[model samples]
Structures are given as structure tokens and as C-alpha cells.
Target: MTHTTLVTSIQESTGKTAITLALGLLAQDGDETVGYMKPKGTRLQSNVGKTLDEDPMLAREVLGTDAEMHQMEPVVYSPTFIEQAIRGREDPDELREIVAEQFEALAADTDHMFVEGGGSLTTGGIIELTDDEIAELIDARVVLVATYEQPGDVDDVLAAADRLGDRLDGVVFNLVGEGDHDELENDVVPFLEGRGVPVHGIVPRKQDLAGVTVGDLADELAAEVVTDVPTDEFVERFSVGAMGADEALRHFRRTRDAAVITGGDRSDIHTAALEAPGIKCLILTGGHRPPGAVVGKAADKGVPILLVRTDTLTTVDRAEEVVRSGRTRDAETVEAMRELLADHADVEGLLGH
Candidate 1:
């Protein structure tokens, strides 16, 4: 019998795809015939005219799975698909049949299948299918991914454990924010274990590892880049220059490769950031371009100025979304994740070897 694991997340940005790919890599390292599948999708990447599943590509590249994208993704919740499902126009049985057929094909000549889940436990509820249902359909154990970013996270994980019950294989804590290690290691892990939720791994927060790029901010915020800088430049920190130039400069200088969000009319703040080292870019909000002197300074300092038509509050929220949506296909990042999970998670235990 082939062993399979279904990776799911309670909240977004729990590094679920990275974890799934890491497990797939571990399986390959053990000389197992690994295949990948995800029955449903929400956060997607565009391909041609059809919506392609993003998670499988990571596993495909890592494991060299022969299953094509259509087979690996199985079903993608496109806009038309969502409309059809909501209007009761699509048959749930037909979808299930399609998933079953594709899964069997992918399972052929494979010793292990790695199935990834959508954002939350209730991801496929609209289509009358849940993560548990998909796991049951494919005979895969559930691995819930959680983050210690919020205290309510504990309640969320416990609730998921209660819901999945024995189907839950283990919990892996990923992307833990700063200063919460003590609580997660001392309080959260023990509490979950006491509640019978097997805690498997607790990955620490590394800002650089989770850093978003200048191009990501531009894409998410719809900002126009005023200077041509490396769009792939990773922003490890973000700061707002709403304070005095001296105070803002102190904070900005302390952050490595940080993006400063401020009004374009704030020449003082603009000048301060331009003078600071390690400042990746400036996000000028409210549709106002910085003064020519400030623009000249930015160009001179090799900093990109991103101008957005929206107000400061809107820009900040969008920036948070882009940063939280961080998932990198970089080779270094993949190797780092593989090493992290190998040390933290018991691949051998999960694989039943």
C-alpha cells in the first residue's frame, strides 16, 4: 500500500506549500516513488486561459513527478466554476468522479502520494467537499499547518483537531512571529499535546525567508514604479514614515532592506529614507509624486519610488497581503525548507518506514 499525507492549513501563510514540497522532497530522498495531488484550489496562478493549481508545480519540480498539471491539480475553482457551483449548475457527483479518476491515474506506479489542501479546513465546502472528505476519498492522513502569530491560533488548531479527530496526523507550526517562541514552545505545544493534538514541528520566524519583493508590492498595490530598480529585491521589513524625520530615520535605518510607505508629499520623510542605508524602496501613497529633488535623491541613492493612487491606509493593508502571500520557488529557499523540516518533522515516522 502506498502511504500518502494531506497537508492543510488553518490560516493563510502558514508556509503550507513549502511544507508540502519539503515533505515531497523528503520522500524522494528516501528513494520512494512520490506523486502529488490537490483536489481543490483557491489561491491560483494563471496559465494560458485555464486556471492552474499553484501547489503542484512546487512538488512537481521538487519530486520530478510525471503527472501533468491537469492530473495533479484535478480541480481548480475558477470564476466560472464557482458561479456554476453556487447556482447548483454543476453536479457534485461528476466532480467527485473526475477527482477519483485523476487520483487513481496519479497513484499508478507511485509508492507515495502527497496531497495539498486549500487555505483552510472548510476550503471545499462550496463544492460539498471538505479536506476530510478529500482525505477519505484518497486515503491520506491530514497534517494541519498552524502559525503562532495570534493567540486565537491555539483555539483554531484545537478546533480543527476536534473536528478532524483521528484523521489528524499531526500539527506543524510554521512562520512563528518574533518573541512568540517562548509561548509556542512552552505553552502552545504543551497545551495542544495535552488536548491530544500531536505537535510535530515548530518552525521559527525568519524575516528574510518570508520577505516579499519590490515587484510583489507593485503588483498587489497597483503602484507605478518611478525608478528602475531590481524588482526581485527582497524587503525584509516595512515601516511608515509618519513620524518626525529623525525618528523615522532611526527606525528606517535599523530595518534591513525595508520598504517605507509614506505620502508622496512628505519631502522630509522622503529625504530621510533616501539618506538611509539598506532602504530598498519608497511607497509614495495618495497619487502624489515626490518633489523633483526627492526623486533625484532616490535615483541617486538607487531606491525605487512606488506611487499608488490609493490612500495610506489602503496601501498599507495591500502591502500586508502581499507580504503574507509570500511563497518562493527559489532554489535556496527550497533547500532551506527541506533542511528545516528534516530536522523538525519526522519524515520517516510519517512515511511509516
Candidate 2:
């Protein structure tokens, strides 16, 4: 029998996919044949004529799962899918059938198959399918990933545990801030366990895990990549250089791996950034090219200079998107997540449950 583990969250950005991938990597490392599948893909990308979700391919590369992309993530909802479903043009039952079939195929010859749900428990209820319902369909044990933002957040997990009943396996508290560690260790875990919900792990927040690299920034902003300086260098912070050279220099000095967002014409800020340490790259906004001397200095310092057409504020907002997007594809981040699971997560309980 294939042991199936379903990882879901109350809302998005709770590190569901990261936890799922961590567990899958652990299972594979133990010499177990691990497989992965995401039923309803929200991060859709094209592959031939079909839409492939990012997680399945990511799992295949990281875990060495034999499951192909099409089989693992088969049913990708188009933009108009929900509209069609409500208008009686799309069949919910048919969607469930495809999911069931693909899931079975992925499970064959595998010791453990991880079923990661998108968004939340009530995510796909619009199309008459939810994580709990899918859990029922595949007989998978459910694990909820909760964000440790506030003290009242435990109620969400308790409510889900109440609803999922016997099928609910446990909970993993993710992105626990420094302030919440004591509460998670002394209060939250005890409270949840007292309420009949098992607490498997509490992962502390790491800035590196939340960072986005220069390559991703360029892609996110559609900026022109003018130079190559470790595109993989993670930018943990962002600074807008609208101040004088001395003020901007001081601000840039305090931040590590900071992306200086300024206009292309601001040679003052440009000169200051080139001389600053921990500078990931310089983002010149407003379609104005920096002076040749400034560009030469950046190139000399081996820092990439991305020239974008968007204004300073809009460019900063797009840069913020990269920070919000927690991508686990980076080698550094993968190792960090693996360490978190190794130290905190209950691997034996999660697998043998």
C-alpha cells in the first residue's frame, strides 16, 4: 500500500509546497520510493498542448520521482474554468475522475505518494472539489500548514482538525517569527495538542528562505539584464535611493544583499552603491540610462546593473513580489528547508501514520 500524505494550508503562502517538498526529499533519502502529485494546479505553465503545474516538475527534479509532469499534475484549470463550471459547461465529476486516475498511476511502485493541495482546505469548493474531499477520494492523510502570525491562529487549525476528523494527521507551524518561538514552544504546541490536534513541527522563519535572486528579479520586472554578477545571489532587502549620496550611502551600508532601486540618471546614488558592500545589484528605473562612467564602475565591481523602464515605486513593488514569492528551487534554500525538516519535523510519524 502506498502511504499518501496530503499537505494543505488555511491560506496561501503558508509554506505548504515547501513542507511537501521537504518531506518528499526526506522520504526519498531514506531509500523509499517517493512520488508526488498536485491535483488542482494554480501555478500553471504550458508544456506542449497541456498545462503543467510547477510543483510536479520541481518534485521530479528534486526527488527523482518517475512520475511524468502530465500524469502527476493532469488537471489544470484554465482562466475561464470556474466561469464555465458555473455555467454548466465544465463537469466537476469528470475533473475528479482524471485526478483519481493520475493519482493511481503515480502511486504505482511507490512507497509514499505526497498529495499537495493548492491554496487552502476550501480552495476548490467552487468546482465542487476541496482538499478534504480529495483526501477522501485518495484515502490520504491530511496535514495542515499554518502561519504563526497571531495567537488566535491556533483556532484555524483546531477548526480544520474538527472538520477533517480521523483523516487529519497533524499540523506544521511554518514561518514562525522570532517573537512567536516562545509561544509556539510553550503555548501554541501545548494548546493544539490539548485540543486533540497533533503538532508535528514548528519551523522558524529565515530571511534567506524568503529572499529572491537577481535573475528572478529581472524576470519579475521584465528589466534588461545588463551585466552578470552572481544572478543566484539572494537579495534579502530592498532600498530606494531617492536621497542624497551621503544619506543613500548610509542607508545602503546598513542593508545586506540590498537591491538599490533608483533612477538611471542618479549617478550620485549609483557611485555610492558601487562602493557599498552587500550590494546584490543596482536597479535603474524610469527608462533613463545611467552615465557610462557609473555603468563602468558597476561592471568593475562585478555587480549586475538592471535597467528597467518602470518608475522607482512601481519597480520596488515588483521587486517586493520576488520577496513574497518563496521559491524553493534555489540550492541554498533547499538545503535550509531540508535542515529544518531534519531538526524539527517528525519524519517517522509523518511517514508511518
Candidate 3:
């Protein structure tokens, strides 16, 4: 069977999921069938006291696959398991076995599999099994997504490249702060190249990712939206806290066409967000019922409301997916991103193209 795997490493909260999704979209531009996997995940949700390492829904979204979430991300080991394993109650090797099994499954039916790593290069309290181990296990090339602002990020990238040995493909310098393009091309690129690490691509900081459907954001955050506004317009910008009228007004002004995603139960926040001037919409997360008065006020103000049961971070994750995918430019930036990958990537060796 012919298969290619693209593994990405990113620091926590650096838009790794966005990049994974973009790569999946790009790979699909050709005739290639793609799959996705998150090899290491620390967050776990318990179902009937059984812990799952990853949120399967995330894998489904990133991979754009119909395969069951469990099948896509099978090597799940929660922090509890890690702690237990450390105490000798659970076999540490069991997690590795699970990941290997899933990698085998993903490899079986796809032309290319995009494997995403959890957190950054060293996360999950298991310093022993760096992302390098997963890359080695899957026999896949590694693409490092280095967050731009870290002071010693270059060192981290270089070290990761060194550890990947032959498996290291390239590095994508992501999350460039807005208006830092000059420093990136002149300073960052040349420095990395001088050290022999090929700079694959650089993703600019985009504000549009804040524009995501209110309902989708609620779904991820597991929250609820509680207004009559068009769910679509509720896309982008979420702030959690006292949803007072003042805060709502400020957020609406500070963010471009943003929605205040908060809890409906908090009448103060709900009412405040509704009253914000030119507010796009108000999303009530946490699945709480919005007070009737708040609902009426929202209607009067012509703002929409949605309800979901997820926390703040999950809400951000879903909203991010919407924003990142909503306004993609197949322009010079994307082409530049691809060129960097092709230049450093061992494409001929990995995919035989």
C-alpha cells in the first residue's frame, strides 16, 4: 500500500489544528485521499469512569473524515493513566501499543495521513517520548510549526530537527504577529537557513479566525446560544466573564464583527451583551437557559443567541476552525507555504511523487 504521512509539531495554543486542517485541504487538491491523527493528547473526558485521551470530534473536524473518532484517534491515554503508569499500576507501553495500532489503521486506507501532535514538542509530562518518537513510530516526516514570538524557539526547532534525524522534513514558522513580515523574511528565514533548517512557511496572524458560527462554537465549548440573531452572524470573537453592558459594548467595539459568547444564565452578561452597541450577536455558552427578559431584550436589540455545553477554551477552538477555514487565500502566501514544504520535505522519498 502507498501512503504518506505529514506530522506537525506546534507549541500549545499556536494554531496547530488550523495548520493541520489547511494541510488536509491542500493535500486534497490533488487526487490524494487524506487521514488525520493526534498522537498525543493530555486532555481526557470520562465516560462512565473510563477516560479517553482525546476529543474524537476534533479529529473528525481536522481530518474531514467519516471514520469514527475513536478509529481516527485510538492512542488515547489520559493524565490519570499517565499518573497510574508512573505508579506502576498501568503499563506505560500500553499507550505506545495503542498509538501504533491506530497508526496502522490510518495508514491502511489513505494516500496521505496528517498526524498532529499534542501540545508542543515536549508536553504531557512524558519527556521520554518526544514527538520524535511518534514520528519514528509512524515512519513519517516531521514538519515543525514554531510559534513566532518565543525567544529561543529557533533552538527548539533546531533541536527537534536534529532529533528527527532523517525524518525531519521542514519547519513552518507560524503565528507571525501582524505586520512582522519584514523581520520574518529577512531575519528569521536567513537565520534558520544558516543553521540548515529549511523554513517551510510562515502563517500571518489573522483576525478573521474569530469569525465562526455561534452554534459551532457552542458545540465545541459545549455551551448554548440564547438569542434570535442569525446563527451565522454569531461567528467570531468570544469573551468570557461578566457580560455586563459595558463589557459587551467594549468587546463589540474592540473586535471586528464579533459576537459575545457567554453564559445565558448570567443575566447580567446576557443582558449586557445584548445591549452592546452594534453587537453582531450574543452566544450563551454552558447550555444554561437564558432568562426570558434577556431573550426579549436580545430580540428588541436584534441580536442572536446560541447555547452550548463546552467550556471557554473549547469554544475558542471551534470558533478558530470556522475563522481559519472561512477566508483562505490561495494566493502568494499559500503558494509560499507549499514551496517551503516541498523544498525541505523529502516528498519523493515519502510519497514517491
Candidate 4:
């Protein structure tokens, strides 16, 4: 019999995909065949003239699964679908049937199957396909991934526990900071376990794991890459060069693998960014082309220069959004995730071993 684990998160950007993929990897390492599916697709993307969810595509690439994309993502929650459901034109029973059929087909030949939830546990509630509802539909165990930023964040986990009840096999805390680790272990974990909630893992926050490539930032902002340097470098964080050149130099020096955002005409800041250590890319705003000297310097230093039409503030906002929406595209990030889970998470407990 195939064991299905539904991995959902309390809120958005809580590392659900990362944890799900890591679990699948662990299962695969144990000589078990694994499959993955996302019942409701929210992160829409167009590929080869077909609209599909991004998560399943990433899973197929990572796991080398043989299932087609449509089988992996049975229903996509597009704008039209959401509108129909809200208008009572779409039948929830029919949607649930579709999801069940796909789930069965994928589980037929695998020892373990991972069903990733939408942005949150309550996602698709309008259509009666929330994470808990889907878990009941597929007879799967639930694993919630939560982000621990403060003491009060435990309330969300408790709430989820109340909702999921016995179906919740465990919870994994992802992206936890170093300073909060002690409190989580001593106080929060014990408190939750006392309430009959299982804390499976506590993953520390790593800058490389949360980073985005310079190319990803450029694509999100629709910026123009003016230089010929490679844009594939991973940017751990972004710095705004709004201050004086000297101050910006000091700030840039403090950051590693960072993208510096400044006005294109600010040649002083541009030059300083190139000279500073760990400056991976320069995002120039206001559509102003940097001076020839600045471009030449950036090119010589192997840093890509991106020109954006928006102001610095808007550009920074878009860049921040890109970084916040982390992707597990590269092998290094996947390896790091595996190591973190191996050291911190109880994979056997999560798998009911």
C-alpha cells in the first residue's frame, strides 16, 4: 500500500515545497519509489502552449517521475475556476472526484506519494477542497509546515492541530532563525507536544537557501540586462544604494552575494558597488543608462547590470517579492535542504516508521 502524505503550510512562503521535496528525497534514498502531486494549482505558468502549476513541474524535474503534468496537477484554481465556484456554477463533488482519480493513479506504482497543498491550509475552502478536506478525500496523513518568527506563531499551529485533529501526523518548523532555536526547543516544542502535537523538525534559516538568482530578479522586474555578464549568480539579499558613495561602499562590503539597487545615473554608487566585495549584480532604476565607464567597470568585474523603468522604491519592492518567493531550482539548494532535514527532522517519524 502506498502511503500518502499531505504537506501543507500555515501561511504563504513557509517552505512547504522545500519540506515536501526533502521528505520525498529521504524516501527515495531509502530505496522507495516516490511520486508527487499538487491537487490544486495556484502558481500558474505557461509552457508549450499549456497552462500548468509550477510545483509539479519542479517535482517532475527533481524526482524524475513518469507521470504526465496533467495527472500530477488535476485541477488548476485559475481566476475563472474561482469565479465559477464562488457563483455556485461549479460542483465541488465533481472537483473532488477529479482529484481523487488523479491521486489513485499516481499512487499505484510508488511506495510513497507526496501531495503538496496550496499557499495555506485554508486554501480552496470556497470549493470545499482545503488541505484537511483533501486529506480526508484521499485518506492521507497530514503534515503541516509552519514558520516560527515569534512566540505567538505557535497559536497558528495549535489552531491547525484543532482543525486537523488525528489526521495531523506532525508539524515541521522551517526557516527558523538562529537566535530563536533555543526557545523553540526548550519552550515551544515541549508546549506543543504536551498538547498532543508532534514537532517533527526545526530547520534553521540559511541565507543561501532563501536566495534567488540574479536572472530570477531580472525576470520578475522585467528589467533590461545591459551588461554581458552572466546573471545566474545566486543573490542572498538586496541592498539599496540610496546613500552616499562612501556609505554605500561600506554597506555593500557588509553584504555577501547581494544585488545592489540604485538609480542608473548614480555613477558614484555604481562605481562603489563594483569595487565593493560580494557585489553580484547592480539593479539600476529610473531607466537611466549608466555611464560607459560604470558599465565597463561592472563588465570587467563580471557583474551584470540590470536597467529598470520603475523608480528605485518600486524596483526594490519587486526585487524583495522575488526573493521572498523562494525557488528550489538548483541542485545546491536541494542538497542543503536534504542536509538540514537529515540533521534536524525525524524523517522516520514523519513517514510513520
Question: How close is every model to the real structure, measured as TM-score?
Answer: 0.82, 0.79, 0.61, 0.82
Best by lDDT: 4
| lDDT tens per residue, model 3, 104-197 | 8877888888877776776534534567777776777777777667546667777777767777667776657656667777887898889777
Candidate ranking (lDDT, best to worst) = 4, 2, 1, 3
lDDT of 1 by residue, 1-353 (tens): 78888888886667777778778778889888888888886668778977876667666677777678888877787777888899998888888888888989988888888888877777777786688778877778889988877678788898888878888989988887658878888888888888899888777766657887788778878889988656778886678889999998898888877889999899999999888897889999999988888878788777889999988888888787677666555445667888888776766655556
Task: Name the candidate, 1 or 4, with the larger lDDT value.
Answer: 4
- Stretches of model 3 off by over 4 angstroms after superposition: 43-68, 124-128, 150-152, 210-353
lDDT tens readout by residue for model 2, 180-200 = 888888988998888888888
What lDDT is reached at residue 74 by model 3? 61
- The residue ranges of model 2 lying beyond 4 angstroms of the native Cα positions read 214-282, 289-306, 312-317, 330-332
RMSD of each: 4.1, 4.3, 6.9, 4.0
Candidate 1: where is the Cα deviation over 4 Å? Answer: 213-233, 236-258, 268-280, 285-289, 292-327
Q: What's model 2's overall lDDT?
A: 0.82
For model 3, the local distance difference test gives 0.62
Question: What would the C-alpha RMSD of candidate 2 be, to one decimal place?
Answer: 4.3
Residue 316 deviation, candidate 4, in Å? 3.9
* Predicted candidate 3, C-alpha RMSD: 6.9
**For model 1, what is the C-alpha lDDT against the true structure?**
0.81
